[model samples]
Target: MDIHYRNEPPQFDGANLQMHFIAEVDGEPLDCAITAEALEDHFGAQSALEGPLREAFQRGQTLIRAVCTRAIEQGAGPVVLHSGRFRSPDVPDVLH
Candidate 1:
């Protein structure tokens, strides 16, 4: 099963930044239990989440986080942060 994440920007409440996201399994959204981490804004993009959809975004973030955390923890092997390996079409993994 493949899970995809759709994010709706970060919601800043003057003091905190709330990241809202959705988890879709096979293109369908599923309600999930999640954990939240307050990250430092190294990029300095201080835009806040507002309007009628703000509350919904916040809830979505929680759901997505929970789903991801649970799934990753259940997987085997060590959890490593930032391998820094990104797929670049311009640069092939193997040189011909």
Candidate 2:
């Protein structure tokens, strides 16, 4: 499956405490999100506030996309990236 990420800006979902972004898998749009906890733990986010979370999302977007791709390839739907996902040994330390 081919994954193409959109150039759209991520939006902060205060209710969910996550940042939502869009992607396309084989031309079909897919919803994806990364939790605030993941951003704080791995992306150098100082706080869960909008500004910091957005900055962190931008800074770590490439790695985030890669993770999303892996998840999609594994048959995940509407990817929801959490802190626990990054705690696995397979994920790189550079994100920490």
Candidate 3:
């Protein structure tokens, strides 16, 4: 699958309390999000506020995109990456 990520900034989805981003799979855009909890747990996000969350997302974008790409390849419709997903041994510690 040709998975390409958009360069757009992640948007805070207050309704779902997650940061949303876009990835194109073979020219089709897929909805993807990372939970605030995940940011806090793995990316050193001190709070759910946009600034901290965005900083955390920037630090962890590589792994986050990898995880999202894996999920999409596995046939997930809309990828929502949570804190627990990052706990896998194969997932790298990409905090900066």
Best by TM-score: 2
Evaluated with lDDT, which candidate comes out highest?
2
User: lDDT scores for all predictions?
Assistant: 0.36, 0.92, 0.90
lDDT of 3 by residue, 52-82 (tens): 9999999989889998888888899689999
Quote each prediction's TM-score. Answer: 0.29, 0.94, 0.92
| Candidate 3, residue 57: how far the Cα is off, in Å | 0.4
Cα-based lDDT at residue 59, candidate 1: 41
lDDT of 2 by residue, 1-96 (tens): 889999999989999999999989999999999999999998899999999999999999998998888889999999999988887777766755
Better of 1 and 3 by TM-score: 3
- In model 1, the runs with Cα more than 4 Å from the true position are 10-17, 31-37, 41-96
